[model samples]
Target chain A: MKKFFLGFALVSLLIAGVLSYFASGDPDGLDKTVEDTGIAAHAQEHPFAGSTFADYALGGDSKFTGLAGALGVIVVLAVSFSLFWFLRKRPDAR
Target chain B: MHMSDGLLNAPVSVAFLVIAAVGVGFALVKARADLDDRTAPMAGLVATFIFAVQMINFPILPGASGHLLGGALAAILVGPYVGALCVTIVLVVQALLFADGGLTALGANVTNMALIGTATGFVVAVALRRLAERGKGGLAAVAFVSAFVNTVVAATGFVVEYAIGGAGGVEIGKVALLMWGLHALIGIGEGLITAATVTSVAAIRPDLVYLLRGSRKPLEVRS
Candidate 1:
């Protein structure tokens, strides 16, 4: 079971690290809808616009998208795993 | 879809934020019943996978692309309560660290993708449990339909939010129609990816699939 999970996590990390670089840079559905409807003009830059890893990259550089994505996967995994660790029901209880 | 901070008005944003907080809080409490040694790890892995797949935006139309929302996939695999937590965690992380979703609009995003998306998907998955337990193909079909509907329903959530307090000159009707059309196309991609992933997971270890817990198809080997 551990091996299966590790393999699954490894594959996910690889996809985020490698294939994410090849993802289309075009606007997503919502963005494109807003743009097409001309409502995009009303969109505001989020407060996190100046975040260190804004737009899923280091310094908003495209070259580091893969690295950024991989880091995000790790962070999300760690956070979720830790959260569930405390939340999970112990067998001895009921 | 990750909406920016500017898309919604402050009042609407705050309202949705409160709604998201309630929904996520409820899920946090409910998730305890679903999480055990096996599913705790499974839920964590599902969340990581969602974060990873969300980065791979596939082109759906001329200039529009879409990515896996993962609501249905997560719900089917780990049960809806834990699934909602997984998605909320990803959304919160993305808003805070990755700048993927807007900080102000985080509540709306969570409400749509985490609460609405997972709830609808889980409902559909449960409704089709018999078919989903038939075989891998059956499960994939159920996954695809649930995911497809999840995307569309989640997109409709945005439309509803926009109708309530949209601060733009665009016609509400236009927003609704375009959103539906675009999301329909995006949903197809979401469906395919979800089907593939769910089928693959069910094939290897059916025990991990929450929706398939009582199915008579695959024999579970206790590890």
Candidate 2:
């Protein structure tokens, strides 16, 4: 079980850190809908747009974006692990 | 789809935030009561996996792309309650850390992606699985259909929210049509990914799949 968990975590890291660099650069479905319908004009910048990792890019470098992606995955994992750890029903581990 | 800030008026955004909060609150309670040691780890892992995959977009057209929503995928792997919570966690992180989703519109995104998507997908998948009355392959087929339908439904959710609180002059009807149509294509990719993942996991660790729980019958894998 531990092996499977480790392997899965490693795979997730690779996908976020490396494969994410290959993701398409086009607007996503929602963004395209906004643009095609002329609603893009009303779209405003996200409140956190100026954050170091805003838009998943950092320091104007693609490599930084990859680093950001990996960091995001790890952060999410850690946070979620903590949340689930506290919330999950543990029936007295034998 | 991550709805950005200013897309919907303040009233609309607040309303969704309230709604999403209620849904998430309920899910948190339910998931807490239901999760075990095994499922606890699976839930965290599923959320992490989803966060990673959501970064990878596949092109649907010349200038458009879509990524995994992962609501159905999570619900099938874990339970619906845990699945919704997982998605909510991912969305929260994306909004706060990556700014990938809008901060003010976080509520709206949570409602569409986490609440509606997981609820609809889980219900549909379970219904179809029972109807199919087959085995592993059939479960995967059902997962595909449910995930596809969930994406469409979630997209429709945005359209509904937009109509209520549209900040732009765009025609709501046209926007709905485009959103639904494009999302249908995106949903195809979601279905394929969900199906493949569910099938793979079901093959090796069928016990881990929430959908297949409590089944005494043999799950014949049709090659």
Candidate 3:
């Protein structure tokens, strides 16, 4: 089970690390719909829009997409894993 | 879909924040039922995988692309409660660190993508799984349909929120039609990606798949 979990996490990291760079730059479905309907103008700047990893780019540079993605995966993995680790059922208590 | 800050009025936004809090708080408590020491890591991995996949946007139409919402995918892989929490975790991280979603609009995004999407997908899967034949293919098919429906229903969630307190002057009917249509196309991508991933995991370690737990299909591979 440990090996399987490691392999799964590795594959996810690989995808986020590498494949994310090739994702299309086009607007997503919701974005495109809002654009078409002209409601996009109502969309406000996110508070953290100027952050390092905003828009999945590092320092607003598209060249660093893979790095940004890898970092995101790591952060998400760490935070979520810690949460689940603490929350998991303890059989010994019973 | 991730709503920006100005898309909704303050009242509606606050309402959803409360709504999201109650919903997520409920899920957080309920998630324990699904998580044993052995399966907790699986739930975490599901969160990471969904985050990774969401970064890759596959083109759906001429000017539109779609990414995996992963609510259905997570729900199918993990149980629904844990799956909702997984998606909520991703949305929180994205909103705070990545700015992929709005901070003020976080509640709405959580409600739509995490709660509504996961519940829809799980319900759809449960309804159809019994009718689906006992094979990996059957499981994959159910996953596909479940994910497809999840996307559409979640899209409806956005439209409902929009109707309540949309800041723009756009027609509600028009927005509804456009959202539903675009998401319908996007849902196909969601279905295919979900089916492929679920099938692969089920093939390698069928025991880890929560959706397949009730089936007595006697899968040949379990490592």
lDDT digits (tens) for residues B1-223 of candidate 3: 7878888888999999999999999999999988988789988899999999999999888777888999889998888999999999999999988899888889999999999999999999888776443676788889899999999999999899989998877899998998899899989999999999888888888888887786776565333
Q: Please provide, for model 2 over B139-160, each residue's C-alpha lDDT reduced to its tens digit, 9 standing for 90 to 100.
A: 8789899999999999999999
The alpha-carbon RMSD values of the candidates against the true structure, listed in the order shown, are: 2.0, 1.8, 1.5
In terms of lDDT, model 2 sits at 0.87
Candidate 2: misplaced stretches above 4 Å? Answer: B131-133, B218-223
What are the candidates' individual DockQ scores? 0.84, 0.82, 0.83
Cα displacement (angstroms), candidate 1, residue B15, comes to 0.8
Write the residue-wise lDDT of candidate 1 on B77-195 in tens digits.
Answer: 99898999999999999989987888889999999999899998999989988888777778889999999999999999999998888768578899989888988998999899999
The reply for model 1, stretches above 4 Å from the true place, is: B217-223
Clashes by residue pair, model 2: none
* Lowest lDDT 10-residue stretch of candidate 1 chain A: A43-52
For each candidate in the order shown, give its overall lDDT on alpha carbons.
0.89, 0.87, 0.88
Error of 2 at B39 (Å): 0.6
TM-score of 1: 0.97
- Fnat scores for every prediction: 0.83, 0.83, 0.78
